[model samples]
Target: MRVGPVGVLVRPRAGVAGLVVAVALLGVAGVAVFSGSLDIAPARVLAALAGDGTRVETLVVVDRRLARTLAAVLVGFALGCAGALTQSITRNPIASPDILGVTTGAGFFAVLLITHPALLPGGSAMLAAAAITGGLVTTGGILALSWRAGFDGLRLILVGISVNAIGMAGVSWLLLRTDIDQAAVAMRWLTGSLSGARMPDVLLLAPFVLAAGLACAYLARDLAALRLGRSVAPALGTAPGRTEALALLVAVVLASGATAVAGPVAFAAFVAPQAAMRLFGTAGPPPLAGGLTGALLILAADLTAQRLPAELPVGVVTAVVGAPFLLYLLHRHRRRTSV
Candidate 1:
């Protein structure tokens, strides 16, 4: 299907694939919520979801597992959409919130507040604000450094690497200054976990996620125009600068909200869009498919981590899975560029 002046090929099979992924995600989420250490049956889980389970089932499924599961889905969706937008804006398959220092920046600011609550008022709102601020500042710095005549993806990635190094150093310094217990807590949070994920945190972030999603939907046509190149974008009546800025804003909001709730989440942002593209056989980012892919990955990973001999952090599991995929992607990109 054509969009704007750019003829975007929307594969007929992509929608079917996305629907399949969504259904798979629900199945995985069910297993994740029901088949944990407590081992609630699927029937009970369903009943609890429908608000008709016994007290014990309700406590296990609705009270505890449901909140964590919902948090995962929301955060995963946010990260996935953020990743797609960032990659599209940069015209780089590998450009992700985590790779571009956005997640690192958010993590740094949130860690700072955690390590020293006296630095600011102690609340989730404060933490979320710090995350969003850090992400915007870091992204702005990357853009400033990368823009010579225009934004260059290679330069942006390199600058992001430098910024990420600095952010990690800052986090390390904070860890050093804090007590052992506090440092451990901070480290666990940095690795990402859905444990103790409360519904209130999810509720607080829902509005931001909804708003960003709506904004992204509205800007889809402009994004299609922008993909055709800066020269072509203006001819197509899309103000490249404004469109890019608004897209970046949406990405930042989504990433910051996810980070505020779920820490950095390792490579969820990076893997999601790439997986969607592969699944859909599309050149451009498939936002809906990407979000579903991300939610599925997170739920599966979280479930795997839970079922292991020793439960591991969800981030650790993702890193183990994603790092290899990242290497493969880099090799493929290198080969393509060389060719």
Candidate 2:
């Protein structure tokens, strides 16, 4: 079945408006690079981009800088798409991998490998695989808990918050017990830097992301069915449990793959789909749209981060950027429900 979008019959211009978002993001990126935040001139940026530039520009701008930017975009897209799928499956507006402790779980495990030389394999690939395992296990735990209580949305969120607290404590314990050098390294990863993303890590993430994305796309119809509640969905030829599991699997893979590539970049998942849902009206989350929006968000944020005097980690910038939006969402939801 060729699953398409859920049409809520919004303004005729709404689709066009989505296209404009990409253009606006590009403008912001260009301004960031041109405003002397980065030493590379536009021509140099263009030249390095085109595979012909000075050695210095090629090394610093193209290899170091642009690679990190691209990593952010790819990771952000994965997280955003996964977030959309999870929210749809659970019918929860605040459902996100970060909030559910999945991302933090991955980070915790990966940090262990980075900290302890005696712990298993220590390569990026091994760390990534471990992270994926951690995320899957964390998600499985949440699902199990949610299932026990008949999968209530409010119950699931409460469980997720509790899990997040536990995961945070685990991360802190790792920080406190590890040696200083290892702690420093793990801390950078935790803060989520796009500082040194190489071609190999990017290549590793590509296939998993593509496969997970396609899986989410294929499940979109069943996802829409799920919003009607578990009992109602069965009458529509949908197996709610199975569909939710599949969506959760896709989300877990996406979240893990993204964390591996870019560490646990904050709020990419929560912010992307929420923004897309707002833009598209009262439709199911648009996987494609969410992915694009995520890419745009990360790209813009990374560009800004690079240009900033302090050059904060892209993830840090995203956290600062997304927190206010999250607060607004919380306030709005509270107000509407109270009314």
Candidate 3:
């Protein structure tokens, strides 16, 4: 399907797959909202959603679970889209915000601010601003280091890996400098928790998420062409450099906002787009499908984490699920290259 100047090739079953994934996401969200420690009945949850529930039920659903759930969904969607954009731009299957150090960079700044309040004087808004700045700086460094002749995917990935290590080390150093209680708090944030997420956090992040999403949708055709190659992209009237820069900006913003809100959520970004492509049977990342898949993944992981005897971070659950899949993907890629 051609939209405007770019062509979007959709598989026959893509729509159906998208619909199925959307329904699954809704179901998972419902389970997440209803199966918390409070254990609101599904019917009452629906009533609360519809503004027709008892005071306590309304508070549980509206004030507590709903905000957290929405935050999860928005963050997941942003990360998924960011992942898809990064993978497509780099033409690297393993490329994601987390792996590329964007999340780590953002997390580093946010943690720094949390541990040392003197850094940023403002509230959550300033913290988010710091995260965005950190992520963009990291991205800029990676691009500058890797751009010898042009943007080389292999070099970019290699540089990103190194940068991620450095960022993590910085985070570790900060954590070590803090006292036990402070370290514990920072550790939870680093591990990614949605425990006390409120409507304000969601509100803070929504604009960035929505804006990035719209920009990605608009650039979908260009992204598809760019994935073909530099030569082909130019022929298709897509400026490869500009498109890549814009795409990276979108990714950095999305990732930074999500990290600011939920800390670094492990491999949600890495897993979502890859899983979506397989499910949608697309040649490249399907942004919408990826977003839905991410939402479902996080919601499911959060629900599981919440239901555990001792509550675990959502990042821990996602890491547990995503690590094996990543290894499998690497093996498969190696096999294909060898062939």
Q: Per-residue lDDT for 1-339 in model 2, tens only? A: 123764444455556757777787667656544444446777878887788988977776666665665676678778888888877876776888898888988887788778776788457888889899989988778767866745666677788888888988998999899889989888888877777687667777788878877786678777778878788989999998788778888888888888877788898899988888787664666666677788788878777676688877788888998898899999999999999
Candidate 1 lDDT over residue span 1-339, tens digit each: 677895745568886787788899889887777776787778879999899999989888877888888888888888888898888878887889898899999999899988998989868778888888888888888889888987676788889988888999999999999999879988998998877677777786789877877787788888888888878999999998888889888888888888888888999999988988898776677565677788888888877877789888889888988899999999998999999
Which is the winner by lDDT between candidate 1 and candidate 3?
3
Model 1 — which ten-residue stretch has the worst lDDT?
6-15
- Candidate 3: what lDDT? 0.88
| Local accuracy of candidate 3 as per-residue lDDT tens digits, 224-262 | 899789899999999998998898899889999989888
Q: Would you list the C-alpha lDDT of every candidate in the order shown?
A: 0.84, 0.79, 0.88
List the candidate 2 regions with Cα displacement exceeding 4 Å: 1-14, 25-38, 41-44
Model 1: colliding residue pairs: none
What are the candidates' C-alpha RMSDs? 3.0, 3.2, 2.3
lDDT of 2 at 288: 62
TM-score of decoy 2? 0.88
Model 3 regions lying over 4 Å from their true place: 1-10, 52-55
